[model samples]
Target chain A: MTLTHEPSGSTAVTSPPVVRRRRALTPTRVLAGMVRVAVAVLIIGAALFPLAWMAIAGFKSKQEVVRTPFQFFPEVWRLENYRTILDDPAFVRTLAITGLGAVLFTLLSLTVNSFAAYAFARLDFHFKRALWVVVISTMFIPGMTILLTSFIVVTKLHMLDTLAVLILPGAAAAVHVFFIRQFYLNIPRSLEEAAMIDGCGKFEIFVKLFVPLSKPPFVVVGITSFLVFWNAYVWPVMTITSPDLYQVQQYLATFRSERSSELAMLMAGSTLAAAPVIVLFLIFQRQIIANIKMAGLK
Target chain B: MSTTVTSPPRSADGTPLRAHPPRDDRIAFLMLAPVLILLSIFVIVPTIYAIYLSFFNWSFYQDSEFVGLRNFTNALTDPEFRAAIRRGVLFVLMTLPIQLLLSFLIASFVTGVGKRLGTALKISVYIPTIISAVITSITFALIYEYSGGLLNAVVGLVGIEDQAWIGDVRLALPAIAVPAIWMGLGLMTLIMIAAMLDVPESFYEAAELEGANWWQRTLYITIPQMKNVLLYLLITGFVAAIQQYELPLVMTGGGPLDSTTLPNLFIFNHFRGDTYQGYSIAAALLLFLVLGAISALIFRVLSSEKLVD
Candidate 1:
C-alpha cells in the first residue's frame, strides 16, 4: 500500500493473455522478466493492502492503533475483537438482518425480474410496450435522488421500520429486468420452439428451459444483486429507525459514534462486514469472470 | 426476434414442428403483475411523489400549502445546494480520470499475466468492490486518521508530516475519493479486461510485429479500440460519483464546513432536518431530471451497458 499500482503498468508490453505464455523465459529476456515480476508483485501487494491493513488493525489494541510512531505489525494478535463483534446482539442482528434481506431480495427480485424479462423476451402481450416503457424510463434514476420521497411513500404505505421496507421497495429493479431480458432474448428460438412442440406452456417453458439455460447471466446478476442489497446504506438509514432493524452497513454507520475509542473493535466490525462477501467472491470468482466473458464475447 | 412468436421458422429441415401457441398475454401478465406492483410502489410512485411534493412547503407529515416553483428556485439559489453540486462535480473530476486510467492499466496487466499470479491479483483488486461502502468508509476512517493512522505511517516513510486527511478541508474530499476509487477499481478493471480481450489478439500481435513498444501499443491501439466501453464506464461512473453519499456521511459527516458534502448528502442532511423536507424533495427532483437526462444520453450513445449493441 506504500505505492499505488501504476509503475506495474510496465507489464504494458505483453498484456494480451494469449501472448503472455507464448514468450520464452531465456537469458535474453532478463530486464523484461524482472519488470514482469515487479508488476506481479506490485499488483498483488497494492490491491490487497487496504483490506490487509483493516484485517491487521483488528488485531491491535485500541491504543496501539493510534500509538505514536505507528507500528505496522500489532503488538498482540487479538481474536477478541472478532468475538466481541459476534457477541454483540446489535452487530450480530445486523448480520442476520442483512443476510436475510440480501438472500430474500435476491430470490424475490430475480424471480420477478426474470418473469418480466421472459415476458418481454419470449412472449407477446398487451401493454408490453407501455410496461416496458414504464420500467425502462425509471432505469437510470439514482436511488439517492428519490430517498426522501421513497421514505414518504413507504411511510405512507406504513412500511417504515418493518422488514418489508428493506426488501420489497428494492425487489423489482428495472436494470435487472433489462439485463435478464437481454440474456433471454439471446437464447435460440429453436429451443423454445422444441419446448413448445413438446406441449409445454409458456410458464413451464420458462421454468424448465429458460431458467436452467440462463444460469451464467443469473450468476452474474444474482451475485451483484446480493451485494447491492447487502451493501445498501442510504435507504436503510432513512427507513430503519429502530436499532433492531440495523443492516450491516447501518451498524457500520454508527460504529464511530457508538464505540468511538475502540479502534480494534471498529476494525473488527469492518472485517466482519467485509469477510463474508470476500469469501463469496473467491468461491464465485471463476464463474463471475467466465460468465462475464460469455456475456461479453457471445 | 419478436417474430419468433408468430412467424414460421427461418430454416426448413426434415424435423417436424407444430405451429406455436397463440400469444401468451395472460401468462405474461400473471408473471409480471407482482413486480409491476412493487416497481410502481417503490420506483414509480416515489418518483412521482417526489415531483408532487417538490411543489409544496410541507415538512415531515405536515399538512401545508403548495408553494408553486418556490422550492425549485430556492434550491437552485441555496448556497449549500449549489456548493454541494460543485463538490459533486469536483469529486467526479478527481475520481473518474484516475479510476479510468488505473483500472485500464491494472486490467491490462492482470489479464496479461500467467494464471496463478493473475488469479491472485484479480481477487485482491475485486475484494474492495464487494465490501459495503459504509464498511469501506469505516476502514478508511482509521486509515485517514490524523495521528498514527495507516496513511500517515505510509507517508512518514517518505518524510511527509502526519496529515488530517478527512479532517482538513483540502484533503477531506480527496480522502473520500480514495476509497471510492479503490472500491470501484476492480469492477472497472474487470470490465476493461473483457473489452481488451474482445479487441482480438491479432491487433496486439500486429503492433508487436511493427516494433511498437508495449506502452505505444496500449496508447495507440488498446486504448482506441476500447473507447466505447471506456466512454460508457466514464458516463456511468460520473453518475455514480455524483450520487456519492455514504463516504461523506460515514467519514467526515460533510467535512469541515461542508467541503465534502455531495449533493445527495446535502439532500440527506436536509431530509433529517424537520423544516426543509419540501425543498430537499424539490432539489432531489431537479437532480433526478439531470441524472435521468444523462442516463438517457448514455443509453442513446451506447446501448445499455450489458454494453449492448
Candidate 2:
C-alpha cells in the first residue's frame, strides 16, 4: 500500500522535454574538441617543421641561412644548389651504389625470408618448434651488439669495402622471417594440399600457389627491407672506407662531417637523400601501417 | 645431403613401395642452405671470434697476445669507460620517455580522429621515419648551429640570446637527442596509432554506456588494450637509445670533451684508433653482455606477463 504511488510517478516518465533542454552543445565537449584540434595541429606541425625548414634552407644562400631572424621562404631561390648536388661525381656514385644495394638487398631478403618462413609455417620436421623459437629469438638481439664481430667477419671474407658486406649481413632478419611466417600461417592449407595431390613438390607449391597469394606481405617486406637497408649508416660507415663505396646515408654522414660550414650544399644533399625514402613511404603507406600492426601482433 | 636418400619409410597409408625414389634432403638443405651458411659466417662465427678476441691484448697493426682477463679488468676499472656507460645511460634516459610519450599522445589523437585526417596524419608522421637518421642529424645540426641557424633565429625572436646548441658540451647530447626523438617519433607514433585503432570500437561503445568520457575511455580501454604495443615500443626504444651512434657521430663527433660519446662510438673509436684492437674487442664484448642482459630482462618481463601479443 505504501508503494502505490504510480499516480504521482507518472510525471517522472514525462521527462523527455527536460532532457531535450539539456541536449545543447556543452562547454566541456567544445573545449575537448578544440583541445583535440590544437594537439593535432601541433603534432603535425612539429613533425613537418624540420623537413620544411630543410627544404626551404636548401634554396637559401649560405649568408641568408645564418642571418638574424630566419626566413621561412627564401628571397631568391637557388636552383644551383640542386644542380650542384646532382652534378657532384661523388654524390652520383654514392646514389648509384645505394640504389643498387637497396634493390639487391630487397630481392635477396624477400626470397630468403619468404622461403624460410614457408618452411617454418608449413613443414613438419624434427625440432621444428625449437628452431622457430631460435630464429625469432634473434629479433631481440641489437645489431650494434654484433658490429665488431660483423666487421671482423667481413674483413676476413675480404668484403670490407664492397656493398656485399652491407647486403649480406642483413640477409636473414629473424623478424622478417617471423612476419612472413605469420602471414603464411593464415593461408588456407587446402591450396597446398591440392598442389600436393597434383604432384607439385613443396618448392613448386610454394612458388605456384603460396607466392601468388602473398603479394601483400611480399610488398610489405620489400618496402621495409628497402628502407632499412637504405637508411643504414653505422655498418656502412664502419665497413666502407672508400668514398665510392658509400651508401646514401654514409655519403650524407661524410658530407656533414667534412663540410660543416657549407649549409646550402648539405641541405641540398639531405633533400636528395630523403627523396627516395619519402617517395617509397608515400607509395606504400598502407602496407607499411599494416606491416607495423602485424609486427605488433606477433 | 644424401642421408635422407638412404633412409626409407612407409607411406602414410603404409603401402609397400613399387618404385621408391631417392629421398632428396638436397631440397630441404637447398631451401635453407643460403641463410644457414650466411648466418654462420656472418653472425654466429663472428660472435664466437669476438668472444675469443676479448680474452687477448691485440692490436690492429700487430699480432695479438693472450692477455687473459686484463682487458675486462681494465674496462671494469677505467674511469673513461665508466663515464661512457654513464653518458650512454643518460642519453637513453633523456630520449626514451619523451619519445614514447610524444609518440603515444600523437597516436592517440590521430586514431581518435577517424578516417582521412587520421590517414594523412599517420603518413606525415611516418615520413621522418623513412628519412635517414643521418639526414635528420644534419638537418638538426643546421638548425642548432650558432650562426644564422633556425633555432637561434627562433630563440632570438623570443628575446633570448643565441647559444651554440651542438657546440656546447652541456647542450650537445640533449641537442642530439632532439633530432633522434624527432626521427623516432614518427614510426613509433604510426605503430602505436595502428595498434590503438585495432582496439575494438565496441570497447569504447561499452565504456561510453558506462558514462566514460574521452579521458576515461583512453585510460581504461585504449591503454589497457594496447599494452603490448606500448611495451614493444618501450623495449625497442630503450635498446635503440643505447645503440645511438650516427647522430652524435655526424653532428657532434662525440665532441666538446666527449660529452656525447656513446658506447658504440667508443667501440668504433677503439677499433679505428691506434693499437687497441684487443681493448676494443673487450669493450665490445662488455657492451654485448650488457645489451644481452637488458634484452633478457625485457624477454622475461614480457613472457611473465604474456605481453608480447
Candidate 3:
C-alpha cells in the first residue's frame, strides 16, 4: 500500500488535493457538512436556551413569566424580583453560609489533601502503600450509600442543623488528593533534593518549591472543592433544617412548590445562586478543561 | 531529577537533618494527620457502619435492633425496591448512549472547527455543566412546566398542543432525563476531546494514505485509541446513573404515580419514613456492592490503559 511506502510523504502531499476535493464537494458532501453544522448548532442552542431563558425570566415580572406565548425578554427589566430575593433574611444568611463555608472548606480541604498527596507522591514512610490503599479505596464507594450513616454520625457529634455538618463532612476527598498526587509525582525529585542541600526543611521545600510549581493543579483542586461546598444540594438539605444555617443551594432547593409559584422570584433566586460558579467557569474555562484532561491522563 | 539526596550541614545530634529518612516518615505522618482523622470519622467509619447497619432495624430516634438477614430478604421481595432498580437501569440505558454519542459528536465537531468557533461552541455547552444542580433542575422544571413553559411554548410554534411534560406519567421519566442528557454533554465532550487528541496523528495519516475514508479511519483508529477513555466514561456514567438522585428528586419529586422514583429516591424516602429504615439501608448497601464490582472491573481497564502506554 502507498501507506507503507511513504506514510509521511503521502500525508504531506495529500493536503492540497484534499482541500481542493473538499472545495469541490458533491451535493451530498455539502449537504453532509451542512447537516453536521446544523446538528451542532441545534445541540448548542438547546443547551444554552434554558439557561438564557432562566436569566431573562429572572428580570421579568411574574405576570410576564406566566403569560401565554412566552415573552422572550422583559419589556421593562424589573429589579423587584431580585430585591424580593435579597430582602429575605433567609436568602442573605444562605448566601453568607455558602460563600463563607466554601472559602473555609476549600482552604481546609486543599491543605489536608495537598499534604496527603505530597506525602504519597514524594515521601517515604512506614505503611505508605497500605495507608494509600486505604485512602484510595474509598473512591470506589458511592457517597449515596453512606448518606444515612453519615447523618447518624453528624447527629451523634451534635452537629446536625449547624453549618459544621455541611462544612466538615466534605473537608477531605480521595479524588482531589489523587489528582493532586498525580501532579506531584511528575515533579522532579531533584528540586526537593536541591532544596535539601540549601538547608531547607521538608515543609519549606513543599511550600517554596512544590506549591509554587503546582499552582495550576492547586487552582483546579480549589475550584473543585469550592464547588463541592457551593453546589452541594442533597447532603445539605438532608442535614441542615434551620434556615439560618442553610447554604445557598439548600435555600434554592426550598423554592419548590409554594415559593416556586412566584416564577419570576424563583428564577431570580436561581440566577443569583448560579452566577458565581458560572462566572468562575467562564473565567477559567481553559484551566478547567486542561485540568480535567490531566485527570484523564492519570 | 537525580535520585540521590544531598547531605546538608550537620545538626546538634551529629546527623544530616535534611537527609534523615526517619524525619520523612514523621513529617509525612504529621502532614497526613488531619485528613486521615477526618476521613476515618466520616468516610471509613461511615462505610463500615453502613454495612453493619444494613443488617439491623435502624432509625435515628429508636435503638437499632439486630435483624440479621431479615432486611436483605425483605429487599428481595419488595416491589417498590424492584421498581426503583428497574427505573434506575432504564434511565441509564436510555441516557448513557444518547449522552455519549452527542458528546462525541460535539467533541469531534469542536476539534474540526476553527479555534475561535470551537471555543465558543465548547463554552456554550459547558455552561450548563458548571451550574448548581439546584439551578439546572429548577430551570428545567420551569421549562417543563405545563402552563407557559418553554417546552410548551416551543411545541406550540409547530402546531402541537402543549402537553404536561413532567406531569404525564408516561413522559415524566424521559422528561427528567432530558436536562440530565443536556447537563452531561459538556464534561463528556471535554473528556472525549482530550482522548481524541491523544491519538497519534500518524495513525490517521497512515490510514488515509491506505485509501481509508474518514469514517473508516475513525472506526479503525480513533475509536480504538479512545477505547479506555470511553470505558472510563461508561463506568463513571453508569455508576452515577445507578446513584441518580437530586435531578429527578427536584424536578418531578417522583410524582405522577411515582413513575420517576429512582433507587436513590426510594432509599431516601424509606430512610426518611418512620419505619423501613433498615430496608432502605439494605437497598443502599446492595446498590453499593453492585456499583463497586462494576467500578472494579472498569478500574482494571484504566490501569491496563496505562500499561499499554
Candidate that scores best on TM-score: 1
Q: Candidate 1 DockQ category?
A: acceptable
lDDT score, candidate 3, position B220 = 90
Order the candidates by DockQ, highest first: 1, 3, 2
Q: Estimate each model's TM-score.
A: 0.90, 0.87, 0.89
Interface RMSD of 3: 6.0
Candidate 3: lDDT over CA atoms?
0.78
lDDT for B98 in candidate 3 is 93
Candidate 1 chain B weakest ten by summed lDDT: B9-18
What tens digits encode model 1's per-residue C-alpha lDDT throughout B58-138? Answer: 877568789999999999999889999999999999999999989888887876677667767777787887888888888
Determine the iRMS, in angstroms, of model 1.
5.4
The residue pairs found clashing in candidate 1 are none
lDDT, residue A266, model 3: 89
Q: Write the per-residue lDDT of candidate 3 for residues B168-207, one digit (tens) a residue.
A: 9999999988888887778888777666766777787788
Top lDDT model: 1
lDDT per residue (tens digit) for residues A1-298 in model 2: 0000111222222111111123567899789778877877887888888988888888988778767666667899888788898999999999898999999999999999888878777764444555566666666555655667777678878998887888999888776776677677777788788878989988898899889977767877888789889889888878888888988888887777688677788898889888888888788776556455424242
Candidate 3 clash pair list: none
Pairwise TM-score winner, candidates 2 and 3: 3
